[model samples]
Target: MTSHRNPAHSLNWHPDWSSGGDLTLLSSDEIAFSVPSRPILAVSPALRPGAGGLLPLPLSLRLVLYFLDLALYGQLDFLGPSDNYLTDVLSLAGWLDSLGATSLINLLLVSGRAQRWPLAVEFLLGARLRRTDLCREALNRFNDDGRWRDTVWQPPGTVSDFATLCPRALPLDLWSSVDRRFMWAWVVADVPDTPPSFGLGDKFLEIYQTP
Candidate 1:
């Protein structure tokens, strides 16, 4: 009698698979048993094209792009202090973190540069700033300490306060929770005061009372 061979044996399977076809698909446990997953890919500025075209950028420009990418991806400490790059990097990092990138907030906290305190406060009241312990520690060092004037007490209070106080702190939609809350509180607290009438109120009303 002639026997038929199984087609499963002829099929190729990835290392991620158990045998072949969907019959022996890799399970979650099997995947965990395999090689460890690599870290998330970071976009490199070296891979980016310049104004001239798709060619290697200048060293200075490359450096700037690298830091900017890191800041965008919420990886700020990767940027070091060279040619005032740290200032720009920290500022950008803070801005990114303010926009809900918690990873950048953690990086900025560990980097230990208080120069970004204003942005940090903005993040504290708005962004999902992780590592609460670290964030509080950094705030204490940068704000609660004697550096309050330089960091916390800038011209405007929150984003709205900034807009009201400066008119250029941010765009209209950039209001923070603190800003809205403070404004609401101000409006609620500001009761209009009644002025003293110079003459009798009855006489004033008589001139136009339902005539």
Candidate 2:
């Protein structure tokens, strides 16, 4: 007796086409799994402005912005601690408040250590210093700490009088021993190392003597 073999089963299987593999063979569904159909979420853009992006303004300013926005449009409170500090934007807010655009007086007060002393002083003197009580308070604090000599070598008018009223908090001997150069350098250059007194003094003297 002769036996006949099925053509499909008799054929040899090869995986590579170049190696005589059949291209018509279909892969079993069990070998391949279905892919997910969920859509991808898009990212939102940043809202803050300036070199450091957002949060560059002091804490007080951020708080003021929050309350001001609430008072302005009867809109939902959106400003928060995470809000960015745009100085120009804040200045406009101040102007709007000045015109009674909002009920809340938007005053961004910055209170920090001596690290911000010079900048604070310049800001205060710019236009806000005309508000005498606030100016006096800031000056009094500086003089009371014996930091006036080091921080503000030649302070504006009446500042010297305030300094005289508040005797140096530290001992005279201690104050004398403390390197003036180092103190000035720390204030001006934000440097940590002690510098030469004569050199520092000469450099600062020009600034102090300037009209």
Clashes of each: 0, 0
- Give me the runs in candidate 1 sitting further than 4 Å from their true place: 1-54, 78-158, 162-166, 173-211
Which residue pairs does candidate 1 place in steric collision? Answer: none
96, model 1: CA deviation in Å?
A: 18
Query: Model 2, 59-139: lDDT tens per residue?
Result: 234433432322221222112222111221233333332332112222222222223343233223321312334434444
Off by over 4 Å in 2: 1-137, 143-193
The candidate that achieves the highest TM-score relative to the unseen native structure: 2
RMSD of 1: 26.0
Global lDDT of model 1 = 0.29
Model 1: per-residue Cα lDDT over 91-179, one tens digit each = 22323333443544444344333234434433332323334344344444543343222111122235554334323322344333233
- For residue 119, model 2's alpha carbon misses the true position, in angstroms, by 8.2
Error of 1 at 142 (Å): 29
TM agreement with the true structure for every prediction: 0.21, 0.23
